[model samples]
Target: MSVLFDRIALIGIGLIGSSLAHDIRRLGLTKEIVVATRSADTLKRAEELGLGDRYTTSSAEAVKHADLIIVSVPVGASESVAKEIAGNLQPGAIVTDVGSTKASVIAQMQPHMPENVHFIPGHPLAGTEKSGPDAGFPGLFEGRWCIFTPVAETDETALKRLRGFWEALGSKVDEMDAEHHDKVLAIVSHLPHIIAYNIVGTADDLETVTESEVIKYSASGFRDFTRLAASDPTMWRDVCLHNRDAILEMLARFSEDLAYLQRAIRWGEGDKIFELFTRTRAIRRSIVQAGQDVDAPDFGRPHPLDKK
Candidate 1:
């Protein structure tokens, strides 16, 4: 619980950055927290919320004496933020990111990082559908996974120190190569968001079904998709553009499986449908058993089945 860093600078005061600020202050992780964002209104709001000891609109100024710097911007803006802070970074600073796509973030930020600094690309697999500075709260990362895609030339001591910081925040930390991390996240995170957006869009485009009817009759399955679809659009757009290759690969595989299910339904193959459903149900059970999620229906919410 002692100070892990003398000063920690947060670039982009959105959900992740603000959440880190809350946890850092709550756990006494840093002597000072410098919060920076491009928007003046957001900077003012961060100050009002007391999320940091110092607030600035300039990223470079925020990191002038910061020992640890976390970039929480969208992946598309990673390069510009890196360029701005590259010249101002203190020697031996630990630079990390909370980007969803690791390879693209590394490609954009690594080149600009100074040789003395440790540029570790990381993704914390934790969030809600909400965003903005107000959406952040303490314990957001507790029991979640924080994966670091460290480069070959990364300093081992710096990496361990960064890991310790996340661990102190109650996160389980792991490391993987950038390419493999991208591939794994494409299916687990990217594809699911893409599917949710697509499904919601399709429902919206249904000419025969009135909007009110769709809302009134929405079942748990459709409601869950809406929750994922409600995530920050700018961040998801950047994720899609940055991780195009891996997402396309997963999309192709998803299409093939969808076609198989379509063929089975067309042929009235009840056994095939039942077999697939049974297998998928087991996967859900495994997730619950692994402590990743609760076994309660509707993600631990009240379901129609519980009404009676």
Candidate 2:
């Protein structure tokens, strides 16, 4: 793969930014990479990891000579980052973001973007219950979906170039309007994380069960919820705030379904309960079939070797 851009600036050196740096360098995606983050320690770590050709604590300086700038900051910080780098952006630079909430990011960053530069809001449906530079690894986005919510005045050339860049990283790119993207992600991503956090919190606050006992006998279901709950609090907090409307809408629907399930259990409606479980099990099988997850037993966890 040839260099897609002469220079690319990463505005936050967290998991997403560092992962992109790994792929960009490995794939020869840019001639040079400029990494900038608000934290001096993160910038120092990024430098030590050799994540970029240049590292700085100033975002404005990072984009001054860059052809492409990818913002990897939390959703709530989008506006400030945009304001800080708006004056320093070079002509015809393509600016994009890896934010989870598209509409809010568009609202926050779009107005501050220069008319000459292209502002494309994007979300890569990929990540783990990890954060920071050390948690990032190569091929993190391979085979994952990268959705773009391009603004009304988005340049065709710029959009195509950005699509190509993600494709070169082995991602499947899709486009949707910001509203639709937010609504879709509300249920698919946001609500699940919210549910996980809530369930974990309930367990933590349990009066009948001891904390050590909860850990000692954690079933797969509870363990999975804890994994999601272990994610970065700042990022999830920003996501919930930025996509409040959509998240609330999804939450209401989920509450209705949960109430129905509770009613079924209370009334001993076995058929209804079985029907719902069967439907959800089918959905899990479909997810595995769709290449989103493995079909192996125990969600693909490696088995321990036995010594006879």
Candidate 3:
């Protein structure tokens, strides 16, 4: 298939950025791939990985003449990237992002977009616990969800081109409003990761438990939580800070439910416990039934670490 883009510039070549680079190469979706990162060392590594046709630490230089520009930086750095590339973007170029948070990214990037360009904010609900260029792999977004929060007057042709880009990389695309996308992700992605980090931190703080003992017994159930806990600290920290309001709202609900469960346990109300557990189990079933592939742990095939 002919590529939809002549050049695709990827800023911040971490796991998500590098993964997109790999898929673009595999699918032949772009005539040339330009990689840019804040650090010169990371840019060198991306070049070493052969992930891009050209590499630079200057985002402005990288995006120049590129038909598609994807910013894969942390949500907090969105504005800086937007400012850096705003003047360099070619007319009619499609500017999108793979940030975890939507509303904030839109707010940051929209102001910097040129009138001739399309600034469509997007989020791909796919990533591994690992990060960095070395940790990325091809087909990471296969069967995954990529949500686009289009502006009220977004260009249809640009939106269609971006949709085709993601679809070619094996993602299922869906469109929603920025506020709605932020709210939905807060519950489904942000809160779960925060809860996992909290639980792991709590376990690590236990006075009676040795770190080695925690490691030894982690295989039972805690290991699953640890995977999310082990995610890139800088990335997750940015997410927590950027999506504060929605995350706190979801956290409040989570705490309320947790308190209810605790009350049931304390009062020996087995019926309440059973009902809540049953409901959650049914939710898992519904997810699987909706083609989530739950049999394969962590989204698709089980992580290699779990095989041992």
List the lowest-lDDT window of 10 residues for candidate 1. Answer: 297-306
Better of 1 and 2 by TM-score: 2
Best-to-worst TM-score order = 2, 1, 3
**Best candidate, TM-score-wise?**
2
User: Which residue segments of model 1 deviate by more than 4 Å?
Assistant: 303-308
TM-scores of the models, in the order given? 0.97, 0.98, 0.95
lDDT of 3: 0.92
CA lDDT of each prediction against the hidden true structure: 0.94, 0.94, 0.92
Candidate 2 has its poorest 10 consecutive residues by lDDT at 299-308
Residue 238 alpha-carbon offset, candidate 1, angstroms: 0.5
Q: Is 1 or 3 the stronger prediction by lDDT? A: 1
Return the lDDT, model 3, position 124: 91
Give the residue spans of candidate 2 off by over 4 A: 306-308
Model 3: ten consecutive residues of lowest lDDT:
293-302
Q: Over the stretch 1-308, how does candidate 1's per-residue lDDT look in tens digits?
A: 89999999999988999999999999999999999999999999999999999999999999999999999999999999999999999999999999999889988999999998888889999999999999999999999999999999999999999999999999999889989999999999999999999999999999999877888888746888999999999999999999999999999999999999999999999999999999999999999999999988667787677789
Cα lDDT of model 3 by residue, 1-308, tens digit: 57889999999899999999999999999899999998989988899999999989999999999999999998999999999999999999999999888878888889989899998899999998999999889999999999999999899988998999899988999999988888999999999999999999999999999889999998778888999998999999999988889999999999999999999999999999999888898888888899875656545635778789
Q: Return the lDDT, model 1, position 284.
A: 92
lDDT of 1: 0.94
